[model samples]
Each structure stands twice: as C-alpha cells, then as structure tokens.
Target: MPKIIEYPKGNFKNSLDLAEAVSSLGGSCDRESCAHKMGLKMSGAFGTKIGTTAKYELITTEKGKLQITELYKLIKNAYNDVERKKFETEAFLKPEVFNKLYDRFKGSELPVGMLSKLLIREYDVEEKQAVPVSKYFIDGLQYLNLLDGNNNLLDYNKSLEVEDDYAEIEDENDLPIKSNYSSPYLPEKPTAQILHIENKNNTTNRVEAETTDFIVHIMGPGIDSQIVIKEEEDLLIVDAMLKKVKKKLQ
Candidate 1:
C-alpha cells in the first residue's frame, strides 16, 4: 500500500494569503525573495513555509531557489474574478491531501479536534503534529468556501455556489477519486472544487438590506456554481467568505 504523504502547513498566514503574495511576486523567486516581497522575516519558520508551498507545486524550486508554477500564473493572469477562482481551485485540489480527505469524508461537518485525531490515526503522525496539520487543512480549505460557518463541509466537488443566475450547483453525491499517491502536495485526483461568498450592507435606500449574490467558477474537479445566500448582517465577510448550499441529508 502507498504511504499517505504529509506536509506541514506553510507560514503564509493562510493558504489564500500565500497565493496572493505569490501572485504579487514576478512569477518566480527564491525563499529569501519570497519573504522579502511578503514583508516577512526569512526565519526557520519562513523556510518551512516556503518548502510547504513548493510541496504543493504552487511554487517550484530551481537551483535551490523558488519560482511560481505556470498554473498559478494562469490564475494570477486570469481576466476575470470567476476565472481566477477556477485556477485557485485547481491549484488547491491538485494536492492529494485535499482529495483523499474530501473523498474519505465527503463534505460532512468535522471539528478541528476530531480531524486531528483522524490524521494521527490514518497517517500515524504524532498527536502534537496532527492537531496543527488538521487546523491547517481546515483553514486552507476555507479559502474555497469548502467549509460552513460551524466547520461543516459545504461541498466537495470544488464547486462554488454562485447566484441562481449562474449554472446550478453541483451535487455532492458525485464523489472524487480517492488519492493513493504517497507524495506530499501532489496531484492525485480530478479537478473541480468551490469558493464563494455573499455580502450585505445597511443603507437608507436599503442598499445594504438586499442580499448580495456571487457567482464563481470552480476549477479542477469543477462543478456548477453552488448557491448559498446569507442575510445582510451575517454577511460580515460578504466578499471573502462566500456561501454554500449543502445537500440536505436524508
């Protein structure tokens, strides 16, 4: 049997922040260059983070330096919001860590503590390490609107639920292929996932009162845009944390 590949979470604040920073870079650089551009110190922790990014192929190392992958550049150069999100979805879902986990659990709700234990048991990682890795996995996936407000998984096909105006959201019953690759951050499954958000405001004309709907194109393992409209006040992060329409369990 293939061993499950494992990697530490990179020190990019969060995966999305790291992607944003890399996009800001001129498409290629080293660890030092990456740190400098992000205005972060190139300490041991930073080095580990850089390594993590490379592990995922978001950035590659050449002659002991780093360079952005062509896929990521496509995302950075995307002409529109939905297209950019599609690239990001492809990048993240490329990792076996995301696919296997999503396959095993689908999009069911899971808390950090429980997930940590699963990691430890499945990969035989140290309990101390498993907890943090679990957190990283959950935190990173949030960038794609894969998780709900209470940590429940909203969807797994990497399908972002946009407004009804867009194509209908994908069905979670469509499961992904379980990853059998033993390499960390390697692509082992199909592409297609999600990232979405909805926002609202308060105004006299009731501008803020109306619900704001977003439409995104999920990349690898892609699916139709899933929709999840939120109340205006609940949309504190309307633009950031999008929305999800979970399949009602029987």
Candidate 2:
C-alpha cells in the first residue's frame, strides 16, 4: 500500500491565522494552549487546523508542542509585501501534494473539473479527502494571487507584463525555475553562480545566487520597477530602498 501523504485540511488563510495565533504565544507552546489562544476547543477540528498549519510549513509540532517555523518567521518578518508574498508562496508550495500539482499545471490553466480526480489518482489522496484538498489548493492560490480569473497560473513571463490598472508582480512561485535569459543589465564578465539550499530531507528549502551583478524586480499592488545591481556597494542602496517599504503587519 502506498503511504498516504498528509495535506492541509484547512484553507491557506485559516492555516495562516492559526500560525499567527501560535506566533502570539512567543512562537511555541503546547497544542492545547495554542488552540485555546485561537478560541478553538480541543477537538478533532482543532487538531485538523494544527495539522494543516504544519502541512503548510508555517508551523511545526514536536512532542505536543506547537511552534512557528523559520519559514513563518521569515514571512512574519518580511521586508515588504512583495517579500512577504514570496515567502508565502514558498509556504504554500511546501506541501508535497500542492508542489506536485504546481509542477504539473504551473504554466497552464488548472483543470477545475478534474482536480479532485487528479488528486485522488495522482497524489494518493483518499476519495473523500480529494475534494477538499483540491478546493484548498485553489483557494490558496487565489489567496496568493497566483491564479488568474480564468484559473490560469501566473507564470514568470506573464508576471513580468504590466497591466494598466495594477502593476506587475513577479511570480514568486517561479523562483525555483532558473531562467537562461541573459539581460543586458547583468554584467558580462562573471556568470551568476546559483545555489540551492536544501533541508535535511534533501528538498530545496531556498534558492540563492552568488553574484554581485543581478537584477532585482520589485513589484506590488501599485508598484512596478526593476533595479540593476552592477556594483557590490549598490546592494546597500537597494537594501535602503527596501527598508522604506518595511512596515509592521497589523
């Protein structure tokens, strides 16, 4: 029998709210205390919420203690809304099933009608659980603004195109997919050395590149701009620019 992989039973927002509650308790606490903090009774429902948060990689559980994760800390302490959305995308894709689904349909439209069936057949989700899993996945993508009105995923190329009303937002979901497009803004001498930071399970937790000359695309609800990094000292200037966007999350 195939091992049934776990998934988040709750929607992304619910999972995030639970993570916020856990954070309010100084990042870690007993499960019951965390539940109580969220005004939820200690029942199967509450357990499911905790499990969902853990599946999102926003929180983790160990020996009856619930703790906010490093990913969650990064999300909570993000430099700006853009960076926060990037981290949130990482958290959303952390689940095995969601990651698999994303890999299959990232640059295309999601088959809404076939989502449940696909989950059951491809991801080993149970018959009864497939519907909710599919629902949660779509809801999560919508929450992250990664899905369009037609249910098409916003790919990296599509994300670069600016709309009239709203600015362009880089598709954080596409960060893992390396691009070979050489920009004239990038220096010609040194090639960017990409680095994959993997966790203990050998899964890539983050991606970083070791190059002083790279492009930084900043975009949000009403902002769209790009900065070229030609000099090492330019990083300090960019850091200062990002700091202007930093604000406490209410």
Candidate 3:
C-alpha cells in the first residue's frame, strides 16, 4: 500500500489560533493545558489543532509539551507590519507540500478550478483531501497577500522587500538578506575563523565576511547559471569549480 502523506487537518487560521494559545501559556504547555487555553477539549479534534500548528512550523512538541517556536515569537513580536508579514509568509510556506505548491505556481495564476485534481495527481494529496487541502492553501496565500487580485501569485521576495536608504547600516556584518531567498540546506548563520598567511608570490589580500548572502549570476555565450550560497557547506560547489579551472590551466 502506498504511504499516506500527512497534512494539516485544519486551515491556516485555525493553526494560528493554536499558536496563540501556546503563546498564552508561556510559549510551552502540556497538551491538556494548551487545549484548555484554546477552549478546546482534550480529544482528537484538539490534537488536529496541535498537528496543524506544527505543520506550519509554528509550534513543536517536546517532552509531551507544546512549545511555540522562535518563528512564532518573531512573528508575535515583530516591530512592524512588513516584518510580521514576512514571518507569516515563512510560517505559511514551512510545510513541504505548501512549498512545493508555491514553487510550481509562483508568479503564475493558480489553477483554481483544477487545483484539487492537480494536488492529487501531482502532489500526492489523498483523493479525499485534495479539495480541502487546495482550499486551505489558497486561503493561506490570500491571507498573506501572496495571491493578487487577478489570481496571479506574487513574487514572494519581491513583494516583501523593505524599502529604505540603508545608507548607514549600524552593523557592517548584518547583511540585509531577503528571507525568501534563504536556502534550506544552509545554516542561518555560519561562524568560521580565517587564518591569513602572507606569501611572497601573492599580492592579493583577502577580506573575510561573516556571511554569504549574495547571488552569483554568471552569464556568457550559451552559459547561464545562478549560484546562491546560504551556508558554509555551499562553498564546496565553488571549490570544486575552482579545482576544475586549475586542472584545465595545468
């Protein structure tokens, strides 16, 4: 028998409610306490709320306790609407299935009429759950303004760019990175100490930066590539490329 993929049984708003409840109890509480805070009884229905909040990556169950995640705290304590919405978008897209949908239909009109069929056919959504899952996904997009009035999905990062002069950034190390552009394979922050050794033959001096938050776009005749390094592990790709170049030169 084919494996049944897991999805949030409740909608996005319901999950948010569960998150709020978890927050009310000092960000972590026992299952019964959390359910009571949400005015929900200790039952399977309440379990679904917990499960759905977890699906959005807002809360985690640790040692029989439901705890709101740091993402949730960031959203709850966001200083401005833009910051809040950015974190909300992150929460909404946390699920693997939801991320898959966003990637497939980003900057394109959602197939509203055929979404259910598409979900089941392409995304492994169960036959019985295709409709509701599609509905919830669309609802989340609408709530987060990810879906525009004409049904075309907005560019996730472009829509959330923080407009500012940024002329005098307080910390030189804190690069202003667009949240959506972050890679899942990388650590959010990487720390490494660099040792510089002077060589008589080399005149180049290297300046080390704390993080890699820029995109490397290479375009030439019949060649187009975009390289994004969000963590130290990603440097292996660059190292391999340099090795190839050195071999060719040798």
Candidate 4:
C-alpha cells in the first residue's frame, strides 16, 4: 500500500508572507471596500476553494522569517483559476455592454472626453476612438488570458477610462509657440543694402494681386506667407527703417 503524504500545514509567518505575495501580485485585501467588486469576489472565491477558513499561519525559523511556500502555492493556484473564470465571463458579456453604451452615446450631447474617462475608469481602456474600444471589448471577450495579461486588474480599455486627461491638457499648455515672421528677407552673411517690402493692402487684396511675389512657407500640407528675412544687410536695413518708422508712426 502506498502512504499518502498530507499537504504541509502553513504557519503564521508563512501565511503573512503568502498574503503579502498575493497582494503584491495585485490582489487586494480590501474585500468589500474594493472599488472593483468583481476582483474581491474572485479573491474570496479563491480563498474558499483553497480551504483557507481563517488567515494562513505565518511561520518563523531560527535562520530568519520565512514565507509560506505552501500557502503561496495554494493562493497562486486559486488566483489563476479565478482570473481564468473572470476572463471568460467578462469576454462573453462585455461586447453587448460596450455596444449598448456606444449606441446610446454616439453623436449624443455627451462629451466624448467625459465619456472616455468614465469608460477607462470603469472598464480599463485607452483608445482615442470608439471603434477601437469596441474592437478591444470583443477581443477581451474572446481571450480570457488577456484580462490579467500585464499585471493589470482590468482590461486596457478600462485603464483608459481611469486615465487623467486633465493632466495631459495641462502638460500641453506648458509648451511655447514659435513663429517664423521677420521684417526683412535676406541670404546668410552680412551685407550693406537691405531691402524690405511691406504689404499695405489686406490679405484678401494681396491674394488677388497677380504680380504679388507669393512667398509660401510649407508646414506640412498647409502654407504660411509670413516672410522671415535672414540676410545680414536686410536685417540691418529693416532694423534701421523700423526705428525710423516707429518714430514717424508714433
């Protein structure tokens, strides 16, 4: 007859280490207080399946404090099982939920920024457009493993909803704007004669003129006509003329 070896009982210190490891693996101990109730429920289910009635025992040895390898194994197994089940459930149901939300809000007065924020926080997503979220939702539904793919509790879509768009806006406002307009146009190096031209007429009149030297600066596909003069003589002449003009205009 073969002797059946009993599973090692976890001690107090071992239990503590196990719990810490589980938490470090992104498992929450908040239970009812957790914002994501599904995660809590899954964790509880795991604990129940593992026969962990009370907290696992923490064990200490002469060498030093030791983590409960057995407890960790049990909890890790439970976590993996619960994650798999949660992924399957979410995958099957998330598409319909996403579709309903998309249809309800598409082209509505609802602010896309706010809507997107809500979706990210609630669902864990990060798409700029609706179609991508919809597609992701479907993909999440098809693959259960993707739910906990990146040590993330929620899907990428849900993360997007939680992201702080205001922070991004504030970051954008910190950048400076550069312009390319100059008084005189010239080639590189110093020169004596600096010639400058001023358009007295409005932009519409200038655009209509056939003989106008339509100088265009290409920024991507768009064109900007704000001439930037860079010749040394032209710069000096423009500077001198501007000083005189300022006196006369004032």
Candidate 5:
C-alpha cells in the first residue's frame, strides 16, 4: 500500500504533460540529462515533479538512473487505445489526493467555489492555488472517464472496477491519511455556466436570474436554508461580500 502524495505542481503541467514526459524515453536515464531534455530547469520544482512521478510508482531510481517501473512501461507500451486507457485510468487512482477525495465524497455534489475553499482548510493550500488544483482534478478526472459528465468519481461497481494491478502502484506514505486532515472540494474557475455538480442533491448550486427571481441555498454547519434571490440590490450585497472575502485572501 503506497502512501498518498500531495498533488504535484511543476514542469509537467497536466496529465497529458506528465504522460508525454514519461513516454519520451525508455530504460534508465540520468536525471540531469532527462531534466535537460525535457526543457525544465534543474530546480526543486523539477525535482518535485520527479518526486511526484516516483510517488505514483511511475519511475524508480536505481543507483543514479531513473528507470520506468514495469507498470509504467506497461502503460506506455499499451497494446491498443483501450489498453492505454485502462492503464492510464489505473495510474490516476494511485495518488493519495484522488483516492482520499473519492473515498471522502463519492456521491455528494456541490459548487466549485465551495470545494476550493474546502481544499484551503484540509490541505493548508492557499485559496488561489487550490482553485487550479480543483480545476485540474475536476476536468482531468472527467476527461479520463473516471468521473462522469457530472464530475463525480465513478464507483467500484461503475464502469471502472478496481483492478488487481492497482496494488502495484506503490511508494512512500503507504497508508490512508487521517480523516481530520481533509477539506471539501470543488474547482475555482468554471467559465461556461460553471457548476460542480455530482448528481447528488446533498448540496445544490445556483447562479441564474429568472427575469426578477432567483433561488438561493445557504449551507453552514448544522444550518441549511433556501432563500429566493430576486432584488438587484441583494445581488449587490452578495457581490460586496464576495469582494470582502477576496480582499481578506489578499
């Protein structure tokens, strides 16, 4: 049981970036040369990305060389598109962040904004950074078909059943993290009618005006209520508070 790793941020921008970097070579390669070939500066940021790769069991260091693990080699040399997807799908689940998130909230749904704030609390991530992390997982997971159209992790009984090969994805932190060390989740920026919907009614999102009517759902610890949002002046008040929150973050 490999441990969960903090989501990595650096040279590899996204999943595709990571896959591309990993696919560029075979056998063992010198870390310095590999980093140089990747057009990334030899810095902690680059190391962070490599560390993340190792954490996901994609690459392992032998003596002074970075060697692709058998599992990763399998993913890269997948016989066909379907095999590639199967391996790639299993690869994402190896991260602690994804597993914990799926384990924590497999069925509930909420707004992207709220999820970003939750990441702030759970992982000590800054408000601004959490937004992108949320967005990455939000879009990436769905793109990988792990999450459905509604952006929720599909269940074990769903399309993706846990494969036995999943056990091979291992690294340090080989244990589930404490529950208290977590926060809620959602993406920060959703441009087009953005809403972090999970298909469950546990939490509802809203952002629309009906000529002169709107529905407002308020959620808090042990307190939940729905209010109608209609007055333009009321929208102003909400807008002002939003700025205040942003100001506080600044």
Candidate 6:
C-alpha cells in the first residue's frame, strides 16, 4: 500500500478576507433605524438629580466605508488562500488515486461520458451502470491482475506444507503412491486504516462565523459539511488500484 501524505493547513489571511467581503454588504446586521447613518454608536452621562435620577439618550454615528471595504478585501484574500490550500491538500494526499484515474482514461479513445461513468464507478462503487458490460470489463481487469504479476506472468504458487488427513489408497499390487494434489498459496491482502482530524480550538472561528453569516444572508440559511477525507486508508486504496492497473497493462 502507498504511504499517506500529510496536507498542510491553509493560511488564515485568505479566510479572513472572505469573511470581511461578505460582512461589508450591509443590511447584514439589519439596523433599520440606523440606515441613514453609515455607523452606529451610543453614549450617555450618569448624574444624580433630585432622588438620584439619571438621564440617558441614544446617539447615532457613521464609520468610514473604507474600513469595511478594507476588511472585505482582507477577508477575500484570506478566503482565496484557504480554498487554494484545500484543493492543494486534497490533490497532494490523493495523488496516486488521481494519477491512476488519469492513466486509465486520459489517452484512451473512450467517449467523455463513458469515461466519466467509469471514473465514477471506480471511485464510488454505488454508482449504477446502465449496461453491465463496463462492470464486467472492470472485474475482468481486476481478476487478471490478481492472477498475474508485475511482469504480466502468472505468479508461481507455493504448496501448503500442512499434513494431509485423507486415507491412503493402494493399487491392486498393494503399492502406495503419493496423490497428485496440491493447494495454491494466496498472497496476503493489504490492510487499511482510517484517521480523522478535528479542529477543537476554533482556530478559524472568525472565518467560520463570517462565512456562516454570509451564506445565511445570500441563501436565507446556512449549511455546512464538516466531512474531511484525510486518512491513510485512501492512500492504501490508491496503491491497490495502481498495482492492479500495472498488472493489467503488463
């Protein structure tokens, strides 16, 4: 099985920039009364009058639009870096799997749609095939690989050394001869491991909050998928598939 590669975490600047951009659109906080004002502020003086009475009032103010604009720019920049790192990490960790896929169909004369279906099937076994022929071809390739080796030659099997329990049979002359039976050795199957990583520190809290709020404003609701595929098992599958392909090609 191939070794798993660790992906680097994304930079924070990109994520922050993305958040700022979304927040600057205004109507975000929904302060209708302060609409006329670009910014909002409140101040009051504490004083005692008569029987310890205090007066309070609301004050409205405006902040520079450039501040919001600059914040958005910073967040957008951060967001780009975050997304770039995500894609980079995904590709780096799954290079073998992606390479196998490219080698299997990239230069082939197969149609785009057919190639897509084949890819989908290879990656996602649950995908249904309209014509079972493709499945048969894939299965055949797998079987062929199982029987062959790197040089495309059948691997010599070792006989089992276990003691036989069957009774010996004698010929008419009462002479005993060994039976011509043997068992083939099977190669050990590869093992797989799955690992999961969770960020408990809320390291990207600001980015998450901003993104969530942005999505809610744009889509009327926020939805997030926390699933991340970062593990050794993926690399094992990639190695297995590559070996199978190599055996077939040879």
Estimate the Cα RMSD of every predicted model relative to the unseen true structure.
13.3, 15.1, 16.2, 23.1, 17.9, 30.3
Give residue 86's error in model 6 in angstroms: 14
Residue 246 CA displacement from its true place in model 6, Å: 45
Q: Rank the candidates by TM-score, best first.
A: 2, 3, 1, 5, 4, 6
Question: How does candidate 5 fare on TM-score?
Answer: 0.51
| Model 1 lDDT per residue over 120-228, tens place | 6776657777777776677666766566666666553333333221223244322222212121121243122223212222223222323354423222232332323
Q: Which residue pairs of candidate 3 clash?
A: none
Top candidate when judged by lDDT against the true structure: 2
Report the Cα lDDT for residue 57, model 5: 65
In the range 17-105, model 4's lDDT, one tens digit per residue, is 34554345354333232213234453555343222212222212223223334434344454433443433333233233343443454
lDDT of 6 at 40: 30
Question: Model-by-model lDDT, in order?
Answer: 0.52, 0.68, 0.68, 0.33, 0.51, 0.27
Give candidate 5 misplaced runs (Cα > 4 Å).
Answer: 1-5, 10-24, 62-64, 107-111, 123-129, 160-250
Model 2, position 81: C-alpha lDDT score: 57
Clashes of each: 16, 0, 0, 31, 4, 15
Candidate 5 clashing pairs, residues 3+ apart or interchain: 3-173, 3-174, 115-185, 115-186
TM-score of each: 0.59, 0.63, 0.62, 0.17, 0.51, 0.16
lDDT of 6: 0.27
Worst 10 residues of 2 by lDDT: 160-169
* Residue 206, candidate 3: alpha-carbon lDDT: 33
TM-score of decoy 2: 0.63
Q: Pick the candidate with the highest TM-score.
A: 2
Runs of candidate 6 with Cα error greater than 4 angstroms are: 1-97, 107-110, 120-124, 128-250
Candidate 5: worst-modelled 10 consecutive residues by lDDT: 174-183
